[model samples]
Target: MLPYLRRLIRDEDALLQYSAQIRGLTAGDIYIGSYFSVAANWLPQIIQAFQQAYPAVHVHIEECANKVMYDGLEEGRFDCCITTWRPFSGDWIPLCEDEMVMWLPENHPLARAEVYPLKQLCHESFIEPLPQQDTDVVRILKEEHISYETRYTAIDNYTTYRMVEAGLGVSMNNRLMTAQWQGRVAILPMDPPHTITIGIAIPSRDGASPAVKKFIHYVQQGISQILAPR
Candidate 1:
């Protein structure tokens, strides 16, 4: 009976704490899960804005694979995620669209080609990135029935970029992934141009904590300003 009473008291205290945090966004924690590329390209500015608005609200970011990020969102382990939009049982707020492009050594014959032919992959040594995961590159190749030689398997896009820079092999990835990279790699659009939508995924905005809601709003605003016509 004493243990039950203590448990009830703890539950009530937790409820009270949650209520207070939501009533006035004075304090709360928001868990954000994202892909490495998304976190790198989109999170910094938005997070800065959010922090300025609510300094007391803590932001925790986790970088994970696409599947893991979406799984965490469904399991309530993540309040929100910045990732490529896919068919999931959640709400998605599109932030931007990214174009899929091929990476080649600057000295390669087709390096400056206007568009890389999908079938041409058959002649190149491909540097497959994240073979364990169905990344956009892998999915695009498979869906288009394009076959290539996987001479190297990179753990991430950065490694893939290095491999391509070293003339080890060619690769394909979203253009946004190369936003911060300065290496000499020729990025070309695919013969059949492919694009992916990247956005925020939330279980339910209506059920979000105050901090999470505010963070989402800031993300929307920040992205809007960045994407607006200059």
Candidate 2:
């Protein structure tokens, strides 16, 4: 491994690429914040692709609750953030839009239904995500005039998923975020159907570092194309 590392460092193309990435990138440190809901699916691919193109740039990720992540960007801690909801003001690069769906424990009675009306879920136990301000489950229900009682609250989104897997409650999750994996939950489309935008909120293109600009371009060129409607 050491020998291979030395060989890679000695390669002319690698050296040139590394040098080029550092030449104009400010701080050489790119901090990215992310709301976990969207990050779980898309962030890994974005990071992997970006790192391959700019190996010299150091990317620091702060994965947190939604609202907090947006705050972090405003506080100048993150050059950009990946979130489900876009605010009224921000320089956004839309990655993809996802359908909001219902998740039920395996074998739960409602799992057999082709679709679930938001109102029909009112009587079942609901698991609200913690920092509760960040997650959308509660907000969606409230907006639809559906009343529910919370049986549990989870700080980690996956922990909430686990609680659902345990048959404790039902909840809402995104289609793209959970696309390739179902885990132990049964996914059903919502009756009225809904969608959420998932994307990056950057400080601004004019004010961003070269590295940030390159990353945003990379995501737009690569990730967005993959996520394009078929």
Candidate 3:
């Protein structure tokens, strides 16, 4: 009798799980997550395109450090999200590469230097951002054996940029964060350079709801078209 009960319980659990996956697909509401930097530059365009195609669907956007977004993905709270580049176990797309740039006060001694070598800036005060998020700053700094003082640590890119603009300290950032900055600052490339890989992560297209599947497909296609070479 106990053996028979075990089989019945297993079957019931499987049935419930399958139903949940089905609901995830056809659900008309979608929530997306992205990093703070890219949220401003990339998400608006993607949202506009997705909503235009799926007029009846409701979409929500949450911007945070990349790790926070990935945590949401693991807990199945978000349908899909943009994550730092990695060989994901689920459906993935290599969106684009972003080059890291050094930001310094306009009148700093190294401001006019043709290039800001990583080792050279190690002596200057560093305005670190998103210390918890996976970033190339700590990676390359450690690799090159460079060390510096953290004059300020920022949770968001805007605060980091503002500090650099005020001549409080220097920091590193990518194109997305630098764009639309109306302040005076010197931007330079690092020696040998570094890049951030951006990609889209979907839980699983086949296992997702119909609405999710449709929107994911549309996003992938539209991103590819826009990013294609001119």
lDDT of 2: 0.72
Candidate 1 per-residue C-alpha lDDT over 31-112 given as tens digits, one digit per residue, 9 for 90 to 100:
7898787689878998887888788778899987677777776666777898887678878888888899999999999998
- Tens digits of per-residue lDDT, candidate 3, 86-205, equal 445677766778888899999899899888888776579899988867665666677778878877899878888888989999998776677767788899888868888777787676
Candidate 3 C-alpha RMSD relative to the actual structure: 6.3
What are the per-residue Cα lDDT tens digits for candidate 2 across 1-230?
65455333334333454466567532255777876654666667877988876777787777786778776665655677877664735687777777889888987888888998888777888877664564666667767888788878878767878889999998787776466666889889998888877787876766566677777787677776676789
The C-alpha lDDT values of all candidates are 0.82, 0.72, 0.73
Q: Give the candidate number with the greatest lDDT.
A: 1
Worst 10 residues of 1 by lDDT: 6-15
Q: Identify the superior model by TM-score, candidate 1 or candidate 3.
A: 1
Q: lDDT at 53 for candidate 2?
A: 69
Clashing residue pairs in all predictions, respectively, total: 0, 0, 5
* Root mean square deviation (Cα) for candidate 2: 8.3
* Residue pairs whose backbone atoms clash in candidate 3: 24-209, 25-209, 25-210, 26-209, 26-210
lDDT of 1 at 137: 80
